[model samples]
Target: MESSLKIGSAQLGPISLAESRYDVVKRLLALLYKAHSFGVKFIVFPELALTTFFPRYWMTNQVDVDRYFETKMPNEVTQPLFDAAKKLGIGFYLGFAELSEEDNRIRRFNTSILVGPDGKIIGKYRKIHLPGHSEKRDDVPFQHLEKRYFEVGNLGFGTWPVFGTRVGMAICNDRRWPETYRVMALRGARVVVLGFNTPTENINHDEPLHLRMFHHRLVMQAAAYQNGMWIVATAKAGYEDGFHLHGGSCIISPTGEIVSQSTTEDDEVIVYDCNLKLGDYILNSVFNFKKHRRIEHYGPITSQTGVDDLIDVSSKL
Candidate 1:
């Protein structure tokens, strides 16, 4: 079952300023066709792939806000995308906003899914770390109201036996957190794939554009090396609704090297043949949890309710 899988990370330019989900799907279909041409078995699309980042603006009406969310996967506009993937016999990861009727009420979440080459749903992940403010920030030029639109994701990080390898899914902000990758790594995930839509400018604070790009690669690279897993990070980049997004979609190795990457901010696919077993050596040696890790001993932080007073380590030394 251990085999080389050709994986692609797509870097997409802005969705139309009008936020057309239909057009987005068309673009995805085009990307799928391109992926097929390259013999890519699996493709990773960016977060909020179905529409422009809608939370960037503030809206009061619930119906108006909910319009951006999909009531069901493979709906009228998106069924063709699923169909194309099936026809091409390629699997993929897609991130989108979800409006689900659960427990007799409508709930919204930032969601993503992993599909098999046969186009069947394999596993799903809801983004747990919802970024930005719930209330509209009028002071800033743009808004990030993810906390207003989405509830906390109920499903914890999960890994699945997929594509003859253990794979996991994460959404935009989730990639920034080390725990997101660590949880899946603990679950025997060989590959942790994620999709993101990150703007070039930080609205909350000032940061150089180049520094933002550096940080994006920095965190994922460290996560891959520390966890001994492959990482595929796809991005919805370039300008969306006047905001410029960073597009550095990449496929990373267990050794924390970027094996493949997107060169353009527009719709681009970068593919690499990933060897799933490459991480075993690191997992069994340096990061072998069962053999060397001692989690029970690190209780000072987990056991405390309030911040612990800083100790003078010099005295102990």
Candidate 2:
């Protein structure tokens, strides 16, 4: 018999830019109730779960930009979520744009947090591998201004012991990279939770609309299989702010098999009974990182690049 951990992946649909914080919180509370009814111990929400994907528009006003960012985790608006989680005795992973003020200096980041069953924050991860352009470009079909509004994540990836499993987290674009999962796996993460807001159509590229879903599952599956860990990837799908997001939240086993997945581009939950011990079985046999990895031959990844050679000649105006 598999020693399973009851997990829930909540895939949120469209969140309009004009929606109020109160409305978002209500929806989140509803999902919490649903997860609790389903007997889920841990629920994973999508990236920027509280608001629309705001990076699609460029904003110069500080007040306007700060409206979309959360200054504190359990602030006035989100306190209900914490209260609900505690009431239900359920842990959850939530992602949002974080805004902090320290020493009168403002810092912004795309961040995610792992909250315990008691509503205490257990772990936090800021997105390090930020994608998209920093400046506004009128030529592109849509904007991806994540780099403009938020700073690169300073906190490196790390894992924590939770729910009888070593768990880790990554946000949106971080899931596309191998290092995000590998670093956490190296720390003995048996499960990795990731959230994304990926568009169904890449207006900047010629790839098929369905390919985004494929890549989403492929990366997580490979990472789980290669690192001997389970991967729970959730997404905010459907059209929001004139862009269509791909919807295919899923749970992948350590062997890379997708155990459970969301069926629609709506607010829905998919549950999985994940066996933490399966990671041990794979690590001891197939993917024993300490016994099989060849690190000495991969030094170029850390080698410094020449400043002049790194510049794009076509980028010069």
Candidate 3:
């Protein structure tokens, strides 16, 4: 299996704000069927995928809030999707809201998991860089309360060996940060799969809707080229609960080229036969880490805990 990976990204259309877990898995199964038809070995889905972007609606009732969180992965409602993937001999990466008991207390996280072709859960990554506010805003039409609902991720960035390539995972907002890709790249990841649910509007600032789409692709492309890894980024897009989400789910090559992308803001599958080893060529050339890296001088880049005026240490060079 030198270069036999047919990777796909599943871009989902809107799931209504009140869709059930059973219904959500049905859409996933449909995508799986489509991928099987295309001979896709692995597929990536969108973040907070099972239901509508519930965080957009602020809630006071605990039961209403907890309804969106899954107490366990592949509980009765989602088990069928895993079974279906195994039956079809396809692996997948899925994103969801996870509710688990840690230290005798229930904790919530925005999470994603990697499933092997055998339907076994391989690895899980909780989203570390949670986006959005922790409370409701009186001025905005809708809320983005990820920070209020989900705790910051606990597991750090990591990669796993499989199919002659190391794979890594990230969630929605994580892709915007360089460290997300670099951390995985440092671990020798040949391909990284991430899922996102981004609203078309920038509530924090007045920005054009087009920039939302551009910025999304820009970061992924930059990450792919800088790290010399394949990137599969999928989205839960379109109008979910009256808010339009960007749906430019795409697959980028090691060269930072858009190999495949979903044009429609709907449930679509885009596949790419990737020769992951192509990334090695870039890694060994201009981006050669061992030959070019100067880590000692980069400490200042990570020293601050919060946004502050940076020291002009680079001027000394």
Tell me the deviation in Å of residue 277 in model 1.
Answer: 1.2
Ranking by TM-score: 3, 1, 2
Each candidate's lDDT (Cα)? 0.88, 0.88, 0.90
State candidate 2's TM-score.
0.93
TM-score for model 1? 0.94
Q: Model 3 segments beyond 4 Å from truth?
A: 306-309, 312-317
Tens-place lDDT per residue, model 3, 24-84, is 8999999999999999989999998898988898899988999989998878998999999
Flag regions of model 2 displaced more than 4 Å.
Answer: 102-104, 304-317
Q: Please list the residue runs of candidate 1 whose C-alpha ends up more than 4 Å from where it truly belongs after superposition.
A: 300-317
Q: Candidate 1, clashing residue pairs?
A: none
Model 1 / residue 136 / CA error / Å: 1.6
Candidate 3 global CA lDDT score: 0.90
Ranking by lDDT: 3, 1, 2
lDDT by residue for model 2 over 261-310, one digit each (tens)?
99999999999888878877788877877788899965554553345444
Which 10 consecutive residues of model 3 have the lowest summed lDDT? 304-313
